[model samples]
Target chain A: MSTDLLTEDQREALQELVNIGMGQAGASIAQVLDEFVKLSIPRISSVAAANLSQEIVRLVGDADVSAIRQAFTTEFRGEAIVIYPEQSMAGLHEVMGYDADTKENKGEILLDIGNILVGACVGGIANLLGMLSAFSAPTLIADQTPAYRLLKPEHIQARVALLVEVYFVLEERDFRCHLIILMPETDILALGQALDRFVDGI
Target chain B: MPLSILVADDSSIARKMLIKALPAHWDITVAQAADGNQALAACRQGNVDVMFLDLTMPDLDGYGVLQAHRDEDLNGLVIVVSADIQEQAQVRVRELGAIAFIQKPVDAGKIERVLKEYGIQL
Candidate 1:
């Protein structure tokens, strides 16, 4: 029995797959905004689920966080998360033409934006992986500190999370999001097969 | 006779792109709205043969537009044009009575194809 979670090659391949998925997403967003959308894959890391939130804050920031998340199941099931700072959501709303006075609708607007982004990102992943996955309606989470605090107790025993950090820039605006793929150790093989199918499809 | 189309989206750039992407010789009248509420009001005044709606908008989203007009006995075809291209999103909009789905950035080829599919000739 092998104790290794994911061979380095597998990690690289998975990261490459995620990059491709995000590329499609970026293109779609650029088209919608009628602007050039640039995306970069800054880093990929494997960490314990217990430290996921802390590591996220370190990579991005500890400020108010808004995210769009969805789950996909093929050989295994895992969540795809995209996190952006709270201020970025306001910028996004502005781009979408919401009135300045409409700030009160931030929660729903943020959820919808996240829904579109995460839907595209996760859909790209599912298409690449050759998996038939459905997405649940998106929900918004505000204030990462409290959310992480709530999640801390349940995440303590979990180990090994696959984190992919992406930086997106729309003209003058700079924003970052993390696409974290979480799966149990037992599902690694299934994930590999899904990746294999995904690569072949591309 | 000039055909009229309603273009609804929150992004000014997107609206401009769609206008630029339309065929130069297509004898059509274009009506633009920034959101669903404005779109609904425009539809009430008639002369709308097609609608290009973005799914994510403040005030009212694309789905709301569809719902508001579903029973209005309007003569226009509702086509959902959005950056949200996930299969699920497409399915939802189609279920809401959209006649067609065109992904964002509005490619000329895609627009041509969809127009042809719906029997709208330039």
Candidate 2:
């Protein structure tokens, strides 16, 4: 069977839905950080497997990066992404009330932050989809790489990905991040149906 | 009788959500703390029956707070609220003497379940 990729309209609607979700996410993050969080509407696009990394780098710009990722499974399943620019982790730590002196606690701190941010983002999406999503706890990945790097080789080879870039700004700091929602092409139809139900209810 | 509770979380959203999830009928006075230090202070200054402590904080984590007050004769329950779901983390917090472990993005159902399990009438 041929893949049912998102049409332009479907893509636009999904992007808007994701933006609303990210608005809630930004508010949640701001509250944790105790600073105002400014977020862009999130630029949405689709990319083939081979060009995924280059496209992400171009969109986010050249900077040392860290990412918090979580996979969400509804009736439809996909990955959600939240990336941070270099040094923003420190800002996050400050928001959580940690200082440089506590470097030993980085793993715990990073994981906790990732869980909160990614959980909120994915939870918001699940709400929009009108589905209950079961999530695996969030994981933090450092080093600038695309989402595919973390995926199984079989997944990278077979699935076309939907990438949504949600740019976040907190206080005076700027951050470029992306939420990549990827599904097997076979699941696109089911995803579209779910999105339709969600939009109608909203 | 109002049960005084202290809520410690770094995220204002989590705190707000937990407050909202409290049973409206319960006679309760809520005090908020942004981190463990404030939580410790609240425990010292006022009567707190239960504390909802977030595990991850800057100055002192939930574990640190529990350790600090472990020997205190304050009669209250300490429920650790965290996003870390790792079994080891849960086991460690339990070993540290948390009365209960609650994962974050707390909802009404979970709270009700916990209250029921603890035999606390909400």
Candidate 3:
């Protein structure tokens, strides 16, 4: 798939969809944590599949981080990855009201957060686009590892990676995480078609 | 006089969708802004009678725009049009003097109802 899979209008439309999705995601997190979640304008970009690890590095840098991966399928097919720096993992316990003593406790909180974020965010976008998407159980991928190490090019068989960057921050706590929705090259065309239909309907 | 409306959002497609969702029979002149600064610029120029603002934007978010609108004492009535539907977000916008708040994927019927409820006749 070429980098020009989505035209300018389609890209803009998708970005708005991501924004709407992120907003819903933020609301869910705010409700769960009993705090306001500050939202940022979602950034959308596509890169060659082989260069995806580099892109992840660019976003989260080479810091030791923990990540959660959840897969969703429908017209939109991909994994939603949430990356948090290792140092911030402790703050999740205080924010989520979990005891920070046991590794199992930390992992449980991470999975729960991952599920809420991916299900709400991705589900929000899918809903806006009128697509029914199903989410797989979120899994804790790696802890205390660089993000790029988890998302190698060969691991993702897609020719093009559509990255929608949205970060979640709790106003009252020191909790923040970066969300990246990586769709395969084949699905890029499908997503483009879906976006065109959405634009046309408007 | 036609109602001078400004739709400020980073997405061109969202702006278009919002315009499409506006009541067709209302006599209105529309303006566009892609960020908070541009929205503020339009407000400063006295080009906005009713402003539809989005919360999460690039340079300046909608909250900053509303703060500036209050500080600068601009004459435009602001209705926040945003996807960020947190209860706190709504409260903050209202605190900043936005007249109303509308959710994203703009619905025409909702827009009409909001406008009517606010007694904004065009």
The TM-score between candidate 2 and the true structure equals 0.54
Best by DockQ: 3
Candidate 2 runs further than 4 Å off: A1-4, A101-104, A143-157, A174-176, A200-202, B1-122
Regions more than 4 Å wrong, model 1? A1-4, A101-104, A143-157, A196-202, B1-122
Question: Model 3 in CAPRI terms: which quality?
Answer: high
* Single-chain TM-score of chain A, each candidate: 0.80, 0.81, 0.94
Docking class of 2: incorrect
Query: Model 2 misses residue A7 by how many Å?
Result: 1.9
DockQ of each: 0.02, 0.02, 0.88
Worst 10 residues of 1 chain B by lDDT: B82-91
Residue B79 shift from truth in candidate 3, angstroms: 0.3
Q: What are the runs in model 3 whose C-alpha is more than 4 Å off?
A: none
* DockQ, 0 to 1 scale, candidate 3: 0.88
Model 2 Cα displacement at B89 (Å)? Answer: 37
Global lDDT of each model? 0.66, 0.66, 0.87
Chain B alone vs. reference chain B, TM-score for every model: 0.94, 0.91, 0.95
lDDT of 3 by residue, A1-202 (tens): 4586778888999889888888888888889888998886788898888888888888877788889999999886889999887766666776678656578878888899889888888898889889899998999998888766877878888788888898887766667788999888788889899999999998
